[model samples]
Target: MTTTRTADPTAEPGAPSTTTQASLYQQLRAHLAVLRLYDAAEHLPAVLDAAIAEGLSMTAALERLLAVEVDATEARRLAGRLRFACLPTPATLAEFDYDAAPGVDRALIDELATCRYLESATNILLIGPPGTGKTHLAIGLVRSAAEAGYRTYFTTAADLAARCHRAAIEGRWATTMRFYAGPTLLAIDELGYLALPAEAAAAIFQVVSQRYLKTSIVLTSNRGVGAWGEILGDTTVAAAMLDRLLHRSVVLNLDGDSYRLRAHQARNETLRKTTTGTRKPLS
Candidate 1:
């Protein structure tokens, strides 16, 4: 028999023996394991077989294997970010109904969705009446920030104030401030929804000042800036906070009929039509 040297010099081969092939595969798997490429290691056998069947080059095969690992890594990262964000619900700019609020500037919203404002540490103020979709827009923007690999947090203004108040009482005020200030984009929803605790204005001001020119904020409020003093219970504190927030900010005023009310009216109309039809005899 004419002997031929296989790729592995010590292999007893005309073609590589099954034992040698298995040994090499095990070594590859071990190396991947050591590198913490668990996803790639798990998919190795199938990927390698497909690569061979397709006659792929070594570099191409490696690329294909690494792509799987990359995808899995991204999925894990996004899930972690979303969990940390504590977003009440999933909302995206694409899911918003611009037609429902004619006063909303669709072009401006599209621009904001690109997330360029975050890069400059700009604030976004969503001012509107109740049920005008301010919270929806704020959530959507924060989701975009999170998707863009920025650390994000979501909380209602009332909840944030209460937490800060409690933290102060527990003597963990500094830690609480750091937690709120840490996110690249901090979204405070439902500002002015309910009366905040006493000293809440000072707490909120500290959070805003801490992040001023350092990170971005997206706040949704039912009351306009003029009424913020009443909401925060201190005109002076509100002014100071607004000074920092508005210095580099995007203020979006969403003016329109309440989406919830519109939906309710629509349902009532449908019911009325159905009831009237039911009263008539079926010919």
Candidate 2:
């Protein structure tokens, strides 16, 4: 039988040294050419160049590609946390308890995965007193949306407002707004925690207004519909904001004992070790 050189596994091929070039792409390309990986290296150049342009070293990019290539078995496991488009999805929905929202309708859970609405770019309002997993469920929903290969962006209302304010001061308002507005689904969490300045409120409202019927957003707030006017500080602005947000929106009113308080009690009980195995001092 004749042995073929291309199929030979023990070939001592020439290897390129990396002492000359300032970049990883040049070095890898040279090495690949020396090893006669011209066809394989064709794809590597573009991927490597893109990674380098994004400020990653050639070696680092190759390492990342190798990890991805070798972890083929983890393709399914990576689905939830990996393929997110606009929002980040959690690793699993199993950790969240839907039973906590006492008066909440079960229709909301069904709506969580409803991509048609999100693709149409509607709003999802998650309102609650405090805790009650409003943020958790919002985040979980956003995560699920992201895992399904939708682009997602997440921020607190305060953070988004502050960022917009800073951008205006820095004269980067247009650029910042363009970037923030481009996401397919933007999640604004913790809405009622801080009072936004008039300008900040206006900026945030502009974002909400611009997003109306154009993009989806997951809003988590601790305000009742009645109290939102006070939080926004301008009735007309608030009214307009409400008109934009509430239309085509799925509102989830989550109310119950504060999860923070329950967590505190649980932690205290766990630490209470005594001689009688009760609430006595450990000493």
> Which numbered prediction scores highest in lDDT against the true structure?
1
Task: Find the 10 residues in a row with the least total lDDT in model 1.
Answer: 9-18
Per-residue C-alpha lDDT of model 2 across residues 51-154, encoded as one tens digit per residue? 75787885877775555444543454446334433334453344576665567666657666666678667788888878688777777766666656666778
Q: Write the per-residue lDDT of candidate 1 for residues 106-189, one digit (tens) a residue.
A: 999999988999889999999998988998898899888888888999999999999999999999999999999999999998
For residue 256, give model 2's deviation from the true position in Å.
0.6
List ranges where model 2 is wrong by over 4 Å: 1-92, 273-275, 278-283
Clashes (N, CA, C under 3 Å) per candidate = 0, 11
Query: lDDT of model 1 at residue 84?
Result: 97
RMSD of candidates 1 onward, in order: 4.6, 10.0
TM-score to native of every candidate shown: 0.91, 0.67
* Every candidate's lDDT: 0.90, 0.72
For model 2, state the Cα shift of residue 178 in Å: 1.5
